[model samples]
Target: MIDLNKLRTFTVVADEGSITKAAARLYRTQPAISAQLKDVEEETELVLFERKNSKIYLTKEGTCLFEYARERIDEIDGVVACLRNNRQNLDGTIRLGVYFELTSSFVPEIVHAFKREHPRVRLDIIELDHDALEVGLLGNDIDLGLVTTLKKPSFFETQPFYSFQRHLVASREYLSTVSSTLTYENIFDLEVIASSNLLSDYKYWLKINQQNQLLKQVDNITKLITVKDAEALRSLIKKGAGIGFYDDFGGQSKSEDYAVVPVFPESKPITINIDVARRKTRTQNLLQDEFYDFLIEKSEAGLT
Candidate 1:
């Protein structure tokens, strides 16, 4: 194997055409430079430099080795520079776990803006339900998460980044079939369109209403349709399939199709709070840490 230090010494001497000049350029003694060159020739069993007068010249073999050595060193230098530049630029992948519903929430816009700012930082977005999102984060399968519930608070650090009011809403077409005044009793009887795996959250919201005495019984949605994702839920809601609860942010609750008329007017609309979360014990990563900071910064700056 050729010693890079010796090969580098040889390349410099060839470039300067003098051991004295190469030594000054490299900040080494002339004798030290000459010794490295001698080791290079012994390794290759070829005299690389032919001293003409006081200047060094590359022999035919020396010229070939010089070209090879110069190319290798330059290539390595370029690679090192590229890697260092990437580190400085905070370029890497962030494995982001998000609740399926929040995928349609403000996350898209936030992610879009983040990507625009960090062109080199890629995101591996995994859509999971509230439970799976936390599981992924705790298991270290995901670098970070946007979770609605922090089930195991001791294991994670969370910051509430976004909050929105969730209202029990249905399309004008669906509401036309029901009484104008919606009671907890009447609303549950109507056809229900459920988003994936959010029954626990919905139950908690119901519990809030119960605490306020705004609702009494939670029994039946005689007809039910469970959608795969927020997009699918939107499609179902758009077609007026059944009544479903949705956030006002970019959801059907604000659309002309959904009748915003006081569904559960007695109780306050359920406020859904989303938290940006990560394991307290997770490994340190520059890209993930930068993005975690970016998320918090952007959220605090009213980007959410």
Candidate 2:
């Protein structure tokens, strides 16, 4: 039977590129680490590394085994973590990433409730956009991510948290310049300000109204000013730079900031779903599991 300890030592040595460095990292003597690596090579019947000019280098087999060993060790560590966290009293920090929209509106209430319940649990929240959230999840920089999306992300195991309506917003001053009724034709007469990332979302919403073709017309006839992000777009709209969009749930509390007018009564508020997601590799983490449940309960109660 291959020893897990030996495999671990080999992996560390491969990562460090030398037994001396690996020994220091593992808090073991250099001789002990070297012996562990030798034992691993003997058991596996593979020459894992070659030494030249006082430096160690991984062979072809060593590179392949390194990947396998690292995965196995990570899996073992995850299992141990899950077991430890299953205790009656929850403790430990959870790094959470949230989009800007939810940061101000929904997160405060959720955090207050969660902290009240589990006072010992620590939460570190960072505001990030959709792309940054994905990167953070994959890099293990965040334990949980809250984001709004029209399409599902393949990399995460996500649970639906809440559904919010996307509202068309503009300053009352700007709207007064147009006809009393807000229509696609009249609205296009003024400039449109929105996040460039949401242009596709706008296109998708237009398709549902059979006004998908209006996309080209809006692009050609009106001046579309694309901003860097939602915050910037909201700022522009508030300053009466142009018309923009925001989630009704996220912005309703700040409705005084802008006027919400539907171009068409049948206009479906672009239903964007806010979802809580974690890496697919993450499993059985008690804190994450409990927090996820709490979010669901709160969402079901219409707290968000």
Candidate 3:
């Protein structure tokens, strides 16, 4: 008989590329993980990994075993979820991935309200980019993903949560130094600050503006400060690092006041739809369904 715990540990080690990292993720010590790996290898009589330059690489057999092991683990999890649902249990960890701005600004309130209603459910939150959030949901790393998109993907079912505008913002101190009125052309030449993410980077911002026919009007940008996430970008912008972009929801909620003024008041503000996404193929338990519906209701009521 195969040990499922060993298989689960092996899959985590394979995914993380380091036993140390896997141990940390699985909340086990390094020696325990090594023992599990050794036991699995002995049971199969296969050399599952190669050690080179103090790092472990999966062997061909390891890769094959890992694929099957991961699938089995997911199956087991689904079965457990179904059993819990049959029992009408709503006590389990619900992992969530959210964009940075929403995580800091609005997600906490929603989470608090949800937790108040369902005291037995545990919510684990992870911050990620819009695209990374989708990947996390599809890969089963997170049970739910809160993100914003111009178009929805076919693989995931998305419920529209909130609507907001992306604004070009500058610090009041920085604006006071500049004599000319803020316009797209003038703002592009200034040092631009932006979040470093697949969807929030300077190029994506430029691309979206180009699609809106506003990019051609602005001058070529040479100066930019890319930060790790929206929170960092907001901090930098507050300190007068450079002009940056912020969503209206965050702009209104954050106390720092980034001074989000309309860049080209004539052109309509960019409209962004925030959505909560879940994998269409995965089966949600009663708890997951309830949480999802709560978010949808709040969004519709303008509560979040």
Candidate 4:
């Protein structure tokens, strides 16, 4: 029978692409790692690596085995964790990926509260852009994602955590110079500001608005101002840069700094959906379920 330790060594070598590096990471000798890999290859009756010019590359069969090796390793880790620890205690790391704008206010509170409740559980919170969040979720790198809902993928199960209305905002000084009532036609009259990376929902709204003559595309606005974070966008508006749409949850709290007004032909502000997602095949632990329940309770309490 092929040894599990040998498979682990092979997997580590394959992941690092160097036996020396893998040995350093695993705290084993380079020759020991090499011997383990050779034994694994011999047991499986397959040559796993191609050595050329002092470099190693995985063969076709090696690639397939590597995937199986990783899955088995994960299974072994799960088993070891279950056997070694008190299952009743809330433990293990939960990785959460959230939007950049939430880092300052909402996310910190949620993480603090959760940590207080389950002190043993390690919470890994990552602030990522929308695209990166989606990619991380799909790749199983993150356990949960908090983001605005543009288009829901069929694979993800979603829950509406909160609603944030979008409002047109500008500096008080800039608004002072303009007329009190703003129309769709006059939208171009003001310095228009918008988020740099367009979400799918934003694109949909833009397409419909442009088609209906509600908004005119201002190509020159790109040169004047561009912001990736919602908070930065609000700061720019406060600095008298330009008028832009800002989410209520993120922007409403800073209303004193800028003049916020409703935009006309108001495309329904997209719902900011916070979803708890995982691989369909994976069963959620008690801690994960409890945290999900806590979030639901918090949402119902309107703490968001």
Candidate 5:
């Protein structure tokens, strides 16, 4: 029989890529870690690592085993946590992942309100960009996510909570220098503040809209300003650094130094529908259900 402890030790060693480092992390001797790996490999009849220039590397099979080991460990930990807190009414941790824009403007309020109602429940909020959010959700790193859904995933289920609109905004200072409205030719010259994923979407939209031809002659590459949060992007716009896009909900919620202008030729305004997504499963917690209900009600009330 394969030992779970041995599998765990192997995973740690593979992740750290050094037995010495893994031993330090696991608080065990290097020999013990090596022995655990040897036991696991012998039991499974598979060599999981390759030694190159005295450095350890995971073989292809080792990589596959590492993924399964990680997921299994996470599942065991979650089950243990749930069981330990089962008797304590509503006294457990809930992991929440959210998009960059909503993290600063909305999530704090929601968390505070929820915590006030259920003081025993612990909330862990992880602020991630769109790509990171998706990756975390798929990897089961978070229990729930609040984000804009551009594409639907087959493995998960989602409930739409609220909708917001995207706006094309520019600083008043930049607007004063340009013609009243931006033509495609001039739009390329203006600095474009965008998140990496948002920029990809914009490029896709431009291609579909057949608006790329007008930008061919422009020398200024559309300046892509990467921001960790929506508020950060707004701050950049307030300084008159560049024109960018932002959620209308954010713009209305905070008073900033910049002026917002609607983009000319009117690209279809994107509607951001925040969805609560989770893996489909039959086993459900009463608290999880109640929290989902609360979110649905609050979202319907438009309380933000």
Candidate 6:
């Protein structure tokens, strides 16, 4: 059966003509948007798009589906609006800057639940890098920001979002080649995949844990494949594209086809912390304040 949510995503992608643009318009990540489009195509069992010159164009079947999707969307919009009007009247706009990796995390569900209560409220979710997300908060461009960083920022009024451990992850096929009990300089012999930020964070972990000698392993990564987002890194690892660093926030670490292990088993445990934040100087409005409290409540409830 076709999922209307995926179909709606198809219409947005069709209207925008670029997965990146569609992601931005819908406040989602490009990878998440691409995955949704793939699902839509699978459900319909037809290729709905073609790529050329780094852009997406509708196929003949896609064009037909787009027309039907638009009609369904038009009708759904009216029904949704009527339902919202009859729901709680709390109304205000809240702009959120979310870390790119967190786009595929549980944050969206939290936002959706908040929307269910304040149906009239407007939320603008922007996918941003950690640096840009922080800049958005400092500049007052976004009302709230979600980010993953090692040291918690002292300036922002913050609430706990998510905390996780990122470790070396690989396919069972790959791990079997190297000793699963890998340590220290053994990394020099293995092909590794990681983002630049992950490399830096790992280095910091090594230094603080007094394992300075192991720092060379991070630098000696001769066979390295770099990717931008956590999802891409995990996807590549699952396909035997070398080992990458990741947290099982999505709880797929025990994924049947793969193995997740400590990047450095001998080192002290290190954690990646994601936080929900607002500028200390930013004034609290009804919607923003309520959403902030809601996030705290979710954290306490372990809602993820």
The lDDT per prediction is 0.78, 0.77, 0.76, 0.71, 0.75, 0.78
lDDT per residue for candidate 3 within 1-304, as digits (tens), equals 6698898999999999999999999999999999999999999999999989868999999999999889989999999999766545468888888886677668879889888777788999998876777778888998888888524488888888888777666677777777567655466677777665232434455565654455543334568677766677778877777777766774573454735444444544456778888888987577678788888898888874
lDDT digits (tens) for residues 14-113 of candidate 1? 9999999999999999999989999999999997878879888999999999998899999999999997677667777889999887787677787798
lDDT of 4 by residue, 181-201 (tens): 866555566766665534333
- TM-score (C-alpha) between model 3 and the true structure: 0.60
How does residue 16 of candidate 6 score in lDDT?
A: 88
Off by over 4 Å in 6: 1-87, 150-154, 179-182, 208-210, 250-252, 255-269
List CA RMSD, all candidates: 12.8, 17.8, 20.8, 19.8, 20.9, 20.6
Error of 2 at 297 (Å): 2.1
Q: How well does model 6 score by local distance difference test? A: 0.78
Output the lDDT of residue 294, model 5: 68
Error of 2 at 6 (Å): 52
Residue pairs in collision within model 4: none
Runs in model 3 lying further than 4 Å from the true structure: 1-89, 150-152, 179-183, 197-220, 250-260
The worst-scoring run of ten residues by lDDT in candidate 6 lies at 256-265
Error of 1 at 189 (Å): 1.7
lDDT winner: 1
After superposition on all CA atoms, how large is the RMSD of candidate 3?
A: 20.8
Query: How does each model score on TM-score?
Result: 0.64, 0.59, 0.60, 0.58, 0.61, 0.62
Candidate 4, poorest ten consecutive residues by summed lDDT: 214-223
Q: Native-vs-model 3 lDDT?
A: 0.76
Q: Once superposed on the true structure, which residue ranges of model 1 sit more than 4 Å away at CA?
A: 1-88, 180-182, 211-220, 250-260
Question: In candidate 2, what are the lDDT values of residues 183-302, reduced to their tens digit?
Answer: 765666777776663566667777776786587765564478986556677677766776767667755625555354544546776777888888888757878888877887987888
